[model samples]
Target: MPSSRSAPVARVSQETCNPAVCAPIAEDDKRALVDAVETFIFDCDGVIWKGDSLIEGVPETIAMLRDMGKRLIFVTNNSTKSRAGYLKKFLDLGLEITADEVFSSSFAAAAYLDSIDFPRDKKVYVVGETGILGASSSSHWPPYDRELDGVGIQHLGGESDGDKKVTLASGQLMEHDPDVAAVIVGFDRNVNYYKIQYATLCIRENPGCKFIATNMDAVTHLTDAQEWAGNGSMVGAIKGSTKREPFVVGKPAPFMLDYIANKFGIKKNQICMVGDRLDTDIMFGIDGGLRTLLVLSGVTSETELQSESNSIHPDHYTSKLADLLTVKK
Candidate 1:
């Protein structure tokens, strides 16, 4: 419950709170908007920087908010990076943030397994990057582990499984390990027939094997302003072959929201979620009962926000996260 503001959240929040639809934050409301919340949870890719290029004034704005004694948390659906990996990126971007402040879908995947009391003796077949394995645990990954901590789930597959091939030579059938109790799917740039086929076998053949997805984001950004296939596309392949849906653990799931809220002891009404995507980012905030701000700097466009068919609406709309730079002590 950290705050520099004297009062609580305003009676009027986002456009969704009003009888009418969403509206842009006026020049005068900038200070009021920032003052209303105790914590700010941000979505990384689209809202912070698209690919390598940093959004103008983001670092300054982040520093400004920190100076005001506000709590800041960065959350992302990209499973390619871990908490340690994201911390390095934030520091490189000139933002004074720590790994404890950043949570990614990769971490979420591990967290989800812990929440459900996943058997320590069992193994998770990962179909994403090393981030899901975390740092201390990454090098130790094998097809299965005899023992593991709750957060450090025993996992394999990931980059290790990316290049492995399966050959059904001379009437032989593909085989899979029964210890693989769960298949965690994230964004794997090297997703090949081998990984998909292996994942399908684990989920479909292995009894009680769980299917988990980091996030079902339709598309993601890897390069400057360019969109590429998201983890959802990789997930879809397994879904098609296994005929099973995955338990998602990223944005729009609200698992991370609950984590930070309880850990910080902040109420949902005392927080505001800012992001560029309506589906995952905005929807995530909405589901968790936090105020939502939609920024037009990433996957979402102004046209998409104003689209007549769109049902998801954030509490406020802004050009970018840097817009809050207008607010001061």
Candidate 2:
């Protein structure tokens, strides 16, 4: 069995520290940063709207960017919604965005599976409700069917037996399915023992079963409140049970970047990623070799940036995305 010990922490060098890794985009350089970028990739939750409310000045700023002919792409680690669903949300929030302009971890996961020619006959056991079913569906690849396709697992918060093991209502041990060739995990609001148990079983019992995840985000910001358990929490449970790491297809993985670049035919250097979180958004930009801009509107703060010890640093820091409008060319 693989040791359950946590991975060793890497020491940060002075040159690799976040501050030394990238300099803040000074007022003088703000204009250049703004002028040089031909495309802007925005993170949805924090950078644009929080919860159901749209952030102030965001609509106008986006409009201005559109007027300037800058290609705007909304990339979110959020997997709860498909691209079509995201378009509905954008429209509901009074933002003018097309379906093609939106991309989510759900879409990325589906695209990845399709790229590798995932076995159409094999079923994917979904542990969450991130629109993965719809995103991965086609005429040949149909949506999840509990009997024909695969099962949707969710935690019902039931009591464990004497040995602290999960049992079905009938007091039977959870059985693994051989047909479940892949386990797809995402943000499952109803995550429970059953979900984790089946996911673990499919991966462990089934031969060559694939473990995949939309994103590894530990927490997500909603309105002014922070949601403690994100998709990462769910993925962690399966990893702990099976000692298996999932193939993450979201930000900081560069898979989305590759998808965007190939689909839009844009150069990496010509794009800039703007978001609030240092780990997902900022590190995503850095890993993709794109200019990164950190905003204080969402999860990360100036204090956090100053104290960050890792090599994940943004090329610029702004009070908000609206501040970019004030930058003069």
Candidate 3:
């Protein structure tokens, strides 16, 4: 077993960004900043769109970046959707994004299991939506887009327990399947005590069972105008019960960062990560040794980015991703 602190990119992580240099990009230097990287990695929820609505200028800005021949990757902590589901979302918002361009935590969780050579006979217990099971309403996904299923790992207890309840009877006996080999906790709108208890049981009772979190984002933009409790809240329940932290596979973990770099055959320094949140998104880029840009259109605000107590800082701050195009030729 490896420590969660053993992230491969620890060289620059011990140091925080100097606030003096973390200032907004000057109008004259924006183009230079843009030109510094050949690849642009984006956080999907806040930086690209909010729930069902596309953020202002997102489509045009993405098109502009594409025209410049920049490699674009959309990394999302939201596990409620598979890569196929996210592609439908982009199309619904008129973004014209391909499925390959999107990388999601659900996929990361599966990727992690594959990396570890998880046994083909063992099964995973998922605490999330149908997306975690690779089962969604999108016509393109179904069995074909099933990530965990595709990897030869079967799963149980996702949306199936949405309507289930655990009545506190005088002698109610609860039981977990002995065959469950790992517990995967992701963002579930229908998360309940039943799901929490079930996941806790698997981690504590099952031998050598691994606890995995798709991500631990504190807040999520589930709707266009409000914040909802992120998957971190759900993972916290199991962690508190089992007294064990999960190996997160989402942003801030660099699992996807390393995956992206290897898949694209590019260098870490050649990539610039643009995201809104300080903890998950920005921290991910900072720890991965890639340039970071924080946008105000998401979870993080300008004050938070420049706070005295705040240690994490991005290379540049902007009101939105569209600001990258503000550079004058």
Candidate 4:
């Protein structure tokens, strides 16, 4: 197990006793430190930027890593944006990276299903709006012409724009074809009771059918430091009603870990799980048996670390990736 530490060294508690305590890495020393890392996995959104603004020293840190010969990947749980969209965002942020270097929860979900030999030419009902649905279809998941029955009826919550209406239903799915293969859950602003009822029926009828999810992020970040309901909430609704656990394929899941490792032809033990969240990023390492690095640039904090009642801990802790510059010999 990797030891853990609080940012200022004063916040150490039973919660911080997992692995190793990492010393702070300064902005100027990021290169020499990360050069020792074969690969670097970065959490976007809070760590890189919040909304449109880039975090201070991030761009330079990325450049320094590139110069140091470390492979980098943008590991994001945000399924709202497309790969091209995120790639463009990276370029716009002056990172000079490609879409190949980035992985989204949406991508992981789609890729996971594709990796499996799911029967072709069957409809996989999607309980999501555009982003999740669109990403799932990126591999040309075809023969899917209609939405699940009652989907349109149930996807009507929160505020609605005229264009964001559900047009499918569960009854319609059963009407068209009774052999639905899977149910993919994602962010659908227009979800409703009918959609839920129908999804439950589909899962119940076909016990072998898959239930895949893009992510379980409980809160989606808003422009004003606010949080709105996310897919985790939606998944909970179905789980509560149906008593079935949907397979998560994002973040801390081994999907991305395996994907990156295979891409780089490295072992899981050789890579470090670096991110801002303890449950997701750090746990990814703990669950997968890899080292973990928890950064304070995102969701989890020192206060949260000290108060954590669980044994979950990271191998190392730092204020940010840039702080790796202070790693001592």
Best lDDT among the predictions, by candidate number: 3
Q: For candidate 4, write residues 1-329 as lDDT tens digits.
A: 33331222232232334433334433333333344357777778767877787877787777776776768888887766556557767778787886678777756666666668555555566666544444234422222211222121122212222133346656654322346677777766667765666667777777686777777878876463777887888788788877988888887677888877887786555456677788777787778766567788877777676564645677567777666544322
Per-candidate clashes, comma-separated = 1, 1, 0, 24
lDDT string, candidate 1, 1-329, tens digits: 11322146454443442324556777556777777778999998878887876888898889899989889999998888777667767777777886678878887778778878898889999888877876444423322111123365677788887778777789887778889999999999999998998899999888999999999988888777568888989999999999898988898997888888888899888788999888898888878878778889887777777777787877788899888887665
Off by over 4 Å in 4: 2-35, 135-176, 308-310, 325-329
lDDT of 2 by residue, 231-284 (tens): 889899999999999999898888999999999999787788998888999888
Candidate 2 regions off by >4 Å?
1-27, 135-171, 308-311
Tell me each candidate's TM-score: 0.89, 0.81, 0.90, 0.77
After superposition on all CA atoms, what RMSD does each candidate show versus the true structure? 4.6, 8.7, 4.9, 7.3
Give lDDT: candidate 3, residue 176.
88
* Candidate 1 accuracy as lDDT: 0.79
The 0-to-1 C-alpha lDDT of every candidate, in the order given, reads 0.79, 0.73, 0.82, 0.63
After superposition, which runs of candidate 3 have C-alpha atoms over 4 Å from their true positions? 1-17, 141-144, 168-171
Cα-based lDDT at residue 101, candidate 3? 89
Q: For candidate 3, write residues 231-281 as lDDT tens digits.
A: 989998898999998999998998999988998898887788999888888
By the TM-score metric, which is better: model 2 or model 3?
A: 3
Worst 10 residues of 2 by lDDT: 1-10
Error of 4 at 293 (Å): 1.7
Lowest-lDDT window of 10 residues in candidate 4? 145-154
lDDT score for candidate 4 against the true structure: 0.63
Which candidate model has the greater lDDT, 3 or 4? 3
